[model samples]
Target: MIGREDWAATALAEIREMTTENFAAELESLEKRKRKKDIERRIIEGPKQPWRPTRHGPMREVILTVNKDWFSEDAAFFGDDQATRENEFGAHAVAWLKANFGDDVIHARADRDEAAYHIHAVIMPRATVEIAKPKAKVPTATATRRMLQPSIHPLIENYEAAQDSVGEWFGGLGLVRGERTAAAIREAREIGQTPPKRRYHAKTWKWRRQEELRLKADARALKDERLALDARVVKVQEREDEVETVFAVAEGVSSGAFVADGASGQPGLIEAPVAKETPPSSPTLDALRKRSPVGFARASGVFGRAWQRMFGQARVSAEAEAAAGVADAMQQVAEADELIAKASALLPQQTRTIIAKIRQTIPAIMRRLEQRVKPVLDDQKQDGKGPEKPRRE
Candidate 1:
């Protein structure tokens, strides 16, 4: 498909330039003879009605081009053996022309043209036919008119027949007519009709190339979608894992495996402890007020035992004063257990719409890691020590 700009570049690619008989001169000569006879007939008949329209004049131009990728990019004609394709395609086209137009096709010369290996020809059809012109007797007649009838090129005469002719020529080379033409022919076959072609096609390599590029872009878009889906799936799994770890720690605290330390002035993660046996699940305000220090130590967990070891006499009283209110401490643990349970049940989901807010943040995470490590690397360099070699992930 040469554009207007490309036409200049492709001028040399026009292979197998063919020139047929001078259609204008020949058609005029036939028209003149036909006119003389028409005039005589008109005089005798007194000018008949419903005459042929002016547009129904004899053919002067019937331009046709046979352009197919098979002749340009296929193995036999072009791709692997370009010379062979150009030669054979031109030869076939010439042979077809001769068959259809006879030796009037005297100037078919194969040229290595076309990134466009197609051939084109213009025809002017004029068939000599026999028409009766009354004479006194045939023996007495001197010479009769070689009547040239108003005939048409096969293309204009019967487009379908012309389609079959051109299609069959390349059929031997494993090429069919255009897709539309082929589909129409298939329908015609089913209906048991031939010729009077109802379909025609004008497709070019440019159209095909655009289709190819469009498919490639669609493929890339699908690939990107798949990658995004995989990333989301991985992030979901990570969220689930984090939720599971939190659930385990909270369950331990809720079941009394770990409890708030009575000895610590501040009850925190490090001061939390597990019960040695079946101690009170959590320290309650009533239990702390009613139970003695010894009973409280037994009810407490590892923290009670650690307090006993660290402060022999003082720990007995420290337990009651450590937490501001035993009920408040138990309430906090209960709230934590509830929070962990909610987080576990939600998994990748959460109270904060974690699932809805999922985003690809690997680059941000990596940048934060680098920010943390820069100071360490700087310290090492300041101490006259080379930074540690970075680990390859």
Candidate 2:
């Protein structure tokens, strides 16, 4: 359906400029009529309703565009002469306008430059109607006078009748109506030929359930990814803290803050540096020791493996002693993991809150994609353009 957006008065000049010889002449001849001056105003005013807030008045003119692709088919298939049948359709359309609207059909032209061959028509708001004259004294004979007035409703109200007449006119050229088209489909079915299935759109319960499951899966996946990133961050923090601890221990040894008793009966400096402070206790660590012994064991094993790798190539030299000095470094990471587990337990709740906010926006996003993005993609697909080539990462 053409609306205000499809057809505008400003486009009239552009249409005129594109006209062929026949159409140009018709439009030129049409401009001389007194009604031509008011065509824009009448068309604009006719489709308005002051009484109804959202309703529009009827259109003052209508344009009918015939499907151009239909003309490309072999006319013999429809039992018509291949050469002249397409021209007949255009003639029949023009004839119908003249027969129906008469002088009120101010201008009509056929345009060929568009994707489809179409007829553009301008109509004045005038209809011929008959009114009975006042009865004679003895009612011997009644007289009537034809009146011309601004009315287009009669044609709209009798639209089916007009369509039937046009279909009958086009029937001579083998054009079929809706009923005939349905009958043909049934006939094909009887002969074991299947018509293409129609596409339908509806939000069914099954689809709704699937969509719900998809959203839940998306939320879960997002939560898992965030948790993995958090774990990486904790690991990096633990590594930094261990480096600092090693530096502090070395500083203590160099400053003589750490000392060992000599094996002999004399005071002597110790070469092996031992930790001066015991590991700090935390509520989270205490909970893990009491309730999750297996988890604590697994964490200890992971730290032990890291310790082995650090001292794997050490010899019985200063290097070997130096390697032993940093063995206690991973203890801090184990305590940090226990603390992180407690923090991570609260993450699912926070993730659910974030997912709920995102869910609220999905409907609007879907609507925008359907309207703006989907049509372009569909058109490109139909044109054999396929999707754009994927870029290399």
Compare the candidates by lDDT and give the number of the best one. Answer: 2
Give me the displacement of residue 388 in model 1, in angstroms. Answer: 78
Which digits, one per residue and each the tens of the lDDT, describe model 2 over residues 1-393? 112443445344333332332233333333434347555554454422211131333234545544566666645455564555446666877787777777556666666645666666655444333222333355423222222233454554554555566677667766654344445566788999986454353333565688789999999999999999999888655543433232222232223332323354232223235443423331232343344454444433443333333332122113333334333333433343444344344445674354344334333322332343335445545776564456799
lDDT of 1 by residue, 92-187 (tens): 777777678653332343333334555544343434433243343434222222221224355556656766787888788666665456566788
Give the whole-model CA lDDT for all candidates, comma-separated.
0.44, 0.45
Runs in model 1 with CA error above 4 Å? 1-56, 60-68, 72-82, 106-115, 130-132, 135-139, 146-156, 180-393
Q: How do all models score by TM-score?
A: 0.30, 0.27
lDDT at residue 314 of model 1 (Cα atoms): 23
The Cα RMSD in angstroms, rounded to one decimal, for candidate 1 relative to the true structure is 21.5
Q: Give model 2's clash tally.
A: 1
